[model samples]
Target: MARFLGRRLLVAIPVLFGVVVLVFLILRLIPGDPAQIVLMGTNASPERVAQVRHQMGLDQSWFSQFVIYVGGLLRGDLGYSYISHGTVAAQIGSRLPSTIDLAAAALAVALIVGVPTGIIGGFWPGSIGDKLATGFSVLGLAVPYFWLAQLLILLFAVDLRWLPALGVGGPTALILPALSLGLGFAAIITRILRSALIDVYQQPYIIVARSKGLSNWHVLTRHALRNATSSVTTIIGLQIGNLLAGAVATEVIFGRPGIGNYLVSQIQLKDIPSIQGIVLFIALCYIVINILVDVSHGMLDPRVRKAWAS
Candidate 1:
């Protein structure tokens, strides 16, 4: 297991490097000079423009600038934001907590809502419970997140005055954003969990459990659930990436302050450093989540550990 983890970590470094390179080059490809954008808002002289460009390292050759950025990254400095005029690491650090909080809450809701629906539906396939669960899952999958957020705002915020339209206040503030994010993930989880449950139920041990006069709940919670956890864990691990991406859209729609909101504003202002920082932070989050997923596979299933050991 330790060897497998070491190999995974070894592989992740190059993947992260590739993601950084791709994201950096793609941002550069987009036609807009960050210095020019900054100058457009001010009555700056040519010297001033040159100064801003020099400070941002835009006056340097692209290769030179790339080297500087790579060097700074290696030293754990994300660089200064060209627009905000602040350290990229500090700016991201401030907003990251909120995004993480929101994403974690949404994923928790997805798991809580999705797993039960799937288990019940799969345990009694084609029953009324199954149909209801499937229908709800369809609704979740079909609804667009932004549209749902807006509708929620209208119904709960405007019409009924039950919750704030935007900006988190309390537990109530979480409901709308969580719902907006969770519904889609819940649908995905439901499909994955249902399939896994179906497969687990077909195993001979399940039949033995049934024949041994075990209650349905006991069999499910113990025998079937143990075997099914790895699949559900895999789905959850994969969805961490989606959750992070969705946070940007959700934060914008809900008027919440998070890394996504900060990113959108920075992109509009053509803050190259901020853009690079945000993408890098997101990439790091993805890599870390994947690592967690790998560890979870071994933790949730001894068979996986045994296979790795072999």
Candidate 2:
């Protein structure tokens, strides 16, 4: 396991490097100057603009900027926002917890709803329950996050008066946004798990377990579910990235103060450092989640473990 983890980290280094390069280059390429945007109402002279650019290190060559950025990263610095004159790391740190709370709640919702529905559908393929699950998955996939968020707000907050429609406060405020962001992913989890369970149920080991006079519930819970862990884990890990992406729209619609909301605001303000920092942070998260999934896969599946061992 140590060897496998070491290898995964080694592989992730290059991927993270590439992400940093892409984020830096892409943000630079976007139209509009950060300095100009920052000094929008000041009517600053060209010399003033030049001074701002120089201070912000925008006057430096791209390569030099990249090197400085990389160097700062080595020192755990994500640079300062051009607009706010605050460290990107500090800004992100303040906002990241809200995003994490939203994402974690959404994941919890997805797992609680998706896993059981999927198992049931797998247990009774072609039955009415299975059909219903499949139909729900399709609907979930088709519904846009913003539209769903509004609908949830309308139903629970407006009409039913059961929850608040906007802003973050307590657990109740989290419910609607989490549902809107998570249900779509729940659909994906349902489809993947249902298919994987179906395949696993038909495997020889499952048949052997059944032939040993095991109950259907026992066969499913003990044999089939264990075998299906790898596939389920993979989907869950992949969906984490989707959850983060969806959070952006969901946070905007719901007025949640997550990283997603912070990111959108920064984009509008053309805060290049903040945008780049946020993108890099998200990319790092993705890479780390993938590594965890790989490790979990190896742990859950004997075949994967064997391959890794070799």
Candidate 3:
């Protein structure tokens, strides 16, 4: 277990480093000067722009800037956000909880809705229920989240007047955004889980369990679910990554407080430090989520744990 964790951590180092470099380089390509944005107006003369650039270390060559940024990262510094006039980490921390809460609620909804639908689809692959589920999952995947978010707002908040149109209203406010965000994730989960369960059902052990006179539900719950969930666990982590990636649009649409909303605001404001910081944080979130999924995989399957042990 220790060795497996160490290996995962070791692997994450390079992935994270690559992400930092990629985001650093990509953000610079966003058109317009970070220095100009920082200096605040087009009226600043070239000399003044140069002075501000020098002060912000934007005057350094791209490679030098990358090195400096990485050096700060190694020391646990995410740099300062000129927009917020504070440390980037601090800014993200203040809004992190809301984003996490939103993502968590969305994930729970996905699991609740997706898992059963998947099982039913796998249990009767050619039945009408399966066909309907298949169509629903496909539609879920096809629809854009921003558009769905609007539809949700229109239906629940505007027309029905059951939910708030914007801002956080405790759990009720959480519902629409979560539903919008999670429907797509649930669609994807249902398909993947259905596939996994179908494959599990065809395995030798499944036949053996039936031969032992186990009830179908007992076999599914005790035997199939545990085996199939290893794959489902991976999807859960990927869903989190997707959820956070989609968060900017969702938060903006709903007027919610989260890293996504903060990030979009900073980008439109052309706050380079904040952009880099937030992108890095999002990348780190992906890495952490995937690592946790891998750990869950081992827990779900003793073979995986043994493989790691050896």
lDDT of candidate 2 over 50-128, digit per residue (tens): 9878876788899898898799898988878757778999999998999999999999999998988888888899999
Task: State the lDDT of candidate 3 residue by residue for 1-310, as single tens digits.
Answer: 8899999999999999889888788656767887787657457889988986886678789888888888988887887875678999999999999999889988888888888888888888899878877887899899998999999999998999999979996899899999999888989889988889899999999999999999999999999988988999988887788899888899999999999999999878778888888889888888998999999999999899989978
TM-score for all models, in order of appearance: 0.94, 0.95, 0.92
Q: Which tens-of-lDDT digit does each residue in 59-136 have in candidate 1? A: 788899888878888888886865677898999889887887789889988988998998878889889988888988
Query: Where in model 3 is the C-alpha error above 4 Å?
Result: 26-33, 42-51, 59-64
- For candidate 1, give the lDDT: 0.85
Quantify all predictions' global Cα lDDT against the true fold: 0.85, 0.88, 0.87
- Model 1 misplacement above 4 A: none
TM-score of 2: 0.95
User: Which portions of model 2 show Cα errors greater than 4 Å?
Assistant: 31-34
Alpha-carbon RMSD, candidate 1: 1.8
